[model samples]
Target: MAFPLQRGLTPQEIEFLSEMEMVTVIPRQRLEGLELLSGPTEKLLPPQRATLPLWLAILLKRQRRVNIVPPHWLHPECLQVILQFETETKEYTDTFSPPPQLPGQRRAGDDSRRQSAAPLRPKYTLDGQRYYPTPPFLPQNTALTPSEASDLEREIALPYHWLEVGNMLLDAASDDLTEPDQVRRLLKDLREVRMSKMRKRVDALDAAAVAGGGVSLTGVGAMEIGEMRGFVAGVVEGLRKIGASREQARREQLAEEGSIQGYTQDDDDMQF
Candidate 1:
């Protein structure tokens, strides 16, 4: 099942080579070119089957193809054949480890998840004053007059505009990143979109809470994560066991209700 780490070959080709040994050998004639590319396995298909990649059709041709694969070029896991061959040198053994999590990432059963999703209680004032659509530093009537130049900003003349300040809250959806839905949402607030939404929602809210936010609720969510993770594990195990039990009962029911094609009248009366 070894894949050859051949130069000029794609990772995809190498992956295919690994899979070949698990089922069948590729035929040399088929491997000659793309004209005869064939079955993932030979025993499963017919000869008249259209040709495939030259290496892939080797089984149909029934001819052995010799490839002087380098010791290091072959992946260790797939090269079971190399271990049996004598006078082969051993390379470094590759060991696998679970993937590392990002810093402050929440593992399963992070208790704080339930807590973080909970909405925050906003503050009442920002330095003994009521909240306003226009903060103190912002210019009065910061509207863009029709007489202004065409390129002038149509948005509030606030110093901390979202387009420049950046949003740490939103996620990107497009590959090019030109489509920011969060930015669109920010542009639609009452102040920006003229719907008068600020006072309605932030009336009693703490302004300080908004300014001094970003206390991660999900970071150490699983802080005491030790056995709490087992809660999620238990749920998965329960579902698996339930599925197995259901499958077993279904098979049993099918076996018990075997074909009744040749049953006599008495047998019919004594149904399964």
Candidate 2:
């Protein structure tokens, strides 16, 4: 017996990839900076916050050397707002709540002035070429300052690795989060609500297979995509097979009609 081949990355693999996302951590002890393949880490000083990858943050938290600061979106109030947007908002009734705006992306009602005022800080490559970073490279999970947090409250959106990062922080640094229990509950509710919408949108998959048609997955997280990949692939494959069968039947019918017409024309010529 042959086993079915896997499509796309697994949830576990996606989770592992998410560990590379940068997060802010408040150190309880002093430590010297070390060079890593990605980049050199900042030296940790007592009570000073520094940005580190999620994997390193979790490791430090486990050793009681630092406390991970949860991102603004991970807060219960923010989660509540996001959940309401996903479930009750008329515009987003069928869509997932939008992900956080990318660098240099203006919000819905922003003016040109604001858009021009806030320029994106581009990262430089080893070759000194400037480029904008996305997802794991962006500091999406990093802790915000008080003023920054307040400003961000106006537009609450999850990051691409929201599920994986949230779970890791909750598991390793629950003490660092304010009302971790509520946060956990809200996360669960949000996941279920978004997943229900995903399932409902399966009817659109056939349309998505057609030219110029697609299902909007604007705010979908990495883990969610991984979870649904196999199911969506199966649905699309089945639809393609059905379409092929129908096309074959239509061609056969057309051929038979043409043959009958040709025979009639020959008989009419013979009669003439």
Candidate 3:
């Protein structure tokens, strides 16, 4: 059997990748840790929350063994705040809201006293080599405890896998989420707003394709990028072809002018 080739990642593939993201889950039963390929999961004990891969969490949730704790940004209040920032904020009117800060990144408006104390802890691999993690390994979708959530310094921006993780949790663990209906609605609204913003960037694609130029995709989610990849790529390719045509015409015009000047100089020399 032959399958048609696709340009960018399909939505299902993006969702599959999101499944590797770590998320917090509250277990209802005790289970011993099992060693698996992507590192052994901690033994899940009742009343003691553990962070596990989203796929495993979803499996346990479906089996009625655990409840997935939605990340703080998945809450309705936070979504409303993010939506407002997207629609109403003057500073972000032309750009998407910023993504979550990486470790040790200092947010704007931080006090000098507090800025010096930001932590940058690196994770260790099974081989004991230290390396900083990003995206799926960053715990961006993991639920924070009450004390940790109380910190006002935590920014409520969306993570890189926002859409996929949000949709997955909403599908498999809606009961665990606060106001799942509202969360779903807000997710839809956010998607529409961001997609509109993405489509509006068509005019800037030409400039982006030029040397030393680029369009900022800092806060775009994987699913969103997959959706827009084909259209944006086509537009950029067309722009590049048009640019090449113009450059070729300009070079021919200069060459013609140089040849004419050379012919005139030769005639002057002949007369002399």
Candidate 4:
């Protein structure tokens, strides 16, 4: 499907965006890591645990030089507890209310609460592993524009919903799977199931949109619908392309095998 207007950043763009988020790390061995060659001649050294940008940390971790310290929100125990509660509770309601203020009045408690509520990083569970979602870029050094700050706040706030977070956590952690590989498989299955549901929903919406009418979902805007439709369509198309490519490869391999078998049979006949 051709998407005319620019909607949202692609997954690759999102990964590039999240590269600047700071993540905690503990060095496993003494090593000379990547140096900041341009700005400063500094390198991450071992024995001193430090917080570094996600991109740098990922590089070091891949090299087995550092161990990543996942944030508190990603803790399995905490996620599990949240998941259990979610399964038990039918409805969730927020109890905390914003502190009232008069004109020209600023309360310290209100400021603190606002700061606490508006977390810098938003957590999302993927394959039983929780991570903060990101967009194209969050400049580490430069000051954030008002728009950037608001975008960050919205991203952080969206995933903080108790019900959705809990459900995602539960989906990641399969009840019977203990082994890492098994749990990963379970998470993959769960993700596929969710994606299928989304695809079906999108199809329904697209059908409605095609049938001389359109439908509205609560909290979802027109722009969002277009973006989601594009995303889902992209995913489905990519999957189809991959499947076709694999099937073609399989067919060629089988044909070659058959040719070899026929050659062997002719050789045996000649010998007879």
Question: lDDT of each prediction vs. the true structure?
Answer: 0.29, 0.88, 0.90, 0.44
Pitting candidate 3 against candidate 4, the one with the higher lDDT is 3
Better of 2 and 3 by TM-score: 2
Clashes of 3: 0
TM-score of each: 0.17, 0.93, 0.90, 0.38
Clashing residue pairs in candidate 3 (N, C-alpha, C atoms within 3 angstroms): none
Model 4 ranges with Cα > 4 A deviation: 1-7, 30-45, 85-88, 92-179, 182-272
Model 4, 220-254: lDDT tens digits are: 21223343667766765665677688889999999
State which candidate, 3 or 4, has the greater TM-score: 3
Tens-place lDDT digits, model 3, residues 145-166 = 8877888877898999999999
Could you tell which candidate, 2 or 4, scores higher by TM-score?
A: 2
Residue 237, model 4: lDDT of 66
Tens digits of per-residue lDDT, candidate 1, 16-42, equal 432222111222233332222222423
Rate residue 187 of model 2 by lDDT. Answer: 91
Once superposed on the true structure, which residue ranges of model 1 sit more than 4 Å away at CA? 1-220, 224-227, 261-272
Candidate 2 residue pairs in clash (backbone atoms < 3 Å): none
Write down the lDDT that model 1 would get: 0.29
Rank the candidate models, highest TM-score first: 2, 3, 4, 1
